[model samples]
Target: MGGDPISLNQDADLHLYMDGEMEPARRAAFEAQLASNPALAAKLDEYRHQQDMLRLGLDMMAAVSVKETETLAGRLRWRLDMDRFSRRVAPLAAAMLLVMGGWSLTVWVQSGAGTGPQLAGEVDDVPAFADEAAEAHSKAIALNTLQPSPPQVEAAPVPMQTAQVPLPEGHVMTVTLPAIGPELTLIRASIVPWNHGTALQFLYREPDGELLTLFVASGGPAQDGTLHTVVQDSLRLVYWRAGLVAYTVTGNKADGDLLTVAKKMADSIRRS
Candidate 1:
């Protein structure tokens, strides 16, 4: 009776929604309320802005790795009370800005600010996965080289054209091995297990005798078809996601067209 009952109830519901704790039916109901209540919708937008700022500030500070930032951001999202989010984030974000230096911070925030959630954190999602893919490619190649080549027979041929790899939870992904050019041959397709999940690795031999591996996994943080590239040492990784699956093309740094190959793979997956 003392406060607006609708605002008080919805403020808590909004927090649950943002924290990803709301039940599906309840979430649907809350979203329907957003359609009818302009004030509630505005409040939702304000909270989202604050959430994005907190994530971006933590990312820009240079003290947190992407994985650690995601964990801390999750806790921050849960604890950001409706009335106190701005107060709690303002001082920390300001200090992060100072630590990052003014000109660079200004450019980064300007580029990503108010562009919705994907652009807010997409830049911070690629490095860890890219490193893993590169490592997997290296290890797979080393193992393959240690094996003895099977005898070639006139009547028998090995099947390297396509492979169906099994995944967790009874899932399966079809990998169409590509022979891109005369010297680029699809060598092997296999499963590599890691922290996130099992990835289907399609290994190929390049024209320069270098190995290229395309890693496909079922899920990734950014699935909006944005290509992210990272280079470490001698390897370059071009990553993108379409629908429910993600793709990464890993090759030598000298191979300047890996991004083009990744884009073509993404287009093929989307079309299929």
Candidate 2:
């Protein structure tokens, strides 16, 4: 409300709407536009994803009522740790059985006969963070750093790098990486510069042989401030903000796993 609203089109506008900062009439107008626009509806779905996940994380982590709790970090961390272990094993155990049996299959595949239905002239309503993360992930695969690019570059791997200096944006801020699980270990911490600002992309090696990157950008908290996943070609990213930072954990089709990590990270941060 303090800054001049820009036709209410910016990310902060999403914040304002979710934050209930708009007047009743303005909010109704925005809702009208949203209802009539499928693209806008899809975008709001992304924001809502985050909001729901964050709320779930809080509920899972909250011990006593907020009014009753003091020094509750330990309780929250224990629950998060338990949740983390439960998620990690369920998948690996299933996959390991396949590997042992020499079984392999893909769940989905797109044909190259120009049969896919992408808009020829239609525009995407997805947020910039999703686009940025997807592009970088594709490139990371193209470079063949960790694995071979999927034929679909048909795909490859990401080369890992660490950054110990400020990014070009002149300001550097990052959230704590998810508390590492035994099944995954940190691999790379690199500066990923996006259109709005620089995001610190922390890469991790998972047991599945695929890679994970967590992008953290500072100072642009969405008003809704929730955890949501944006699913797209070549990648999936779960985004949310806490305190001064907005964070996303992206991967090469790790939509479900990413959200699990996101919720754990969110819970971990909220614990303190």
Candidate 3:
């Protein structure tokens, strides 16, 4: 073995020799030089050891990178599935909330807490034409168009003030004359224009000279035989339905008194 190191060009060839890229003749010559030059041989051993360490480090990094990529892909897939599930469920949850809210609102309205009209019976609401009836009464009174009744007339079907205005065809309603107490005199009876159909308006005079109006229409709901009352324009109005005929009695009287008169009138029409 020589004590001196190899030349620079021969040292550069060491890697080619170690990697077996050198020609066979050159590889044999380099091996003989390594056997004789101890320093060159030691240097080749060090380069080989460094290459092995670098290869081991690169393998470890590649394994860690692959594992991390798999974990990241799994988390992304889980998140996508959760997002899809939420999208499918969102509309159903919104619909349930809307239905529940509507139900609660209906309950509040029916419980008499809302601003809608209150009823004394199991009926849903006041007659739809109640406000119209009240307005007609006021207009008639303001115009002083009501006639005075003949003194001491009994409760009977009064003569029509104008030509008979019949309900529109296809309406199943029976126009029955209301038989109220003798204390209420029929002052005027006429057919008036109504929204759903023609309506019968009857003007009556109470014992105290207070005027009362009874409006009859064909647009009532199914007869629940319940009396409902509401106040409009400072007038107490009592209303009910019998079969297809609906009746509203309005007067500047106490609620109980007006309701009593309405019930009697409704009963008379039902019997007729």
Which prediction has the highest TM-score against the true structure? 3
> RMSD in angstroms, all models?
19.7, 24.0, 33.7
Clashes of each: 0, 20, 0
Clashing residue pairs in candidate 3 are none
Ranking of all predicted structures according to lDDT, beginning with the best and ending with the worst: 3, 1, 2
Off by over 4 Å in 2: 1-124, 145-174, 222-225
Alpha carbon lDDT of each predicted model: 0.64, 0.58, 0.70
Total backbone clashes of candidate 2, pairs 3 or more residues apart or in separate chains:
20
The digit string of per-residue lDDT tens for model 3 on 101-160 reads: 755643443443432233464334555677778987887665443333446555664432
The list of candidate 1 runs beyond 4 A from truth reads 1-128, 144-167, 171-183, 253-255
Error of 1 at 166 (Å): 3.6
Indicate which candidate wins on lDDT. Answer: 3
Better of 1 and 3 by lDDT: 3
lDDT of 1: 0.64
Each model's TM-score, in the order given? 0.44, 0.44, 0.47
Q: How close is candidate 3 to the true structure, as a TM-score?
A: 0.47
Clashing residue pairs in candidate 1 are none
Clashes of 3: 0
Model 3: runs farther than 4 Å from truth?
1-125, 145-165, 169-173
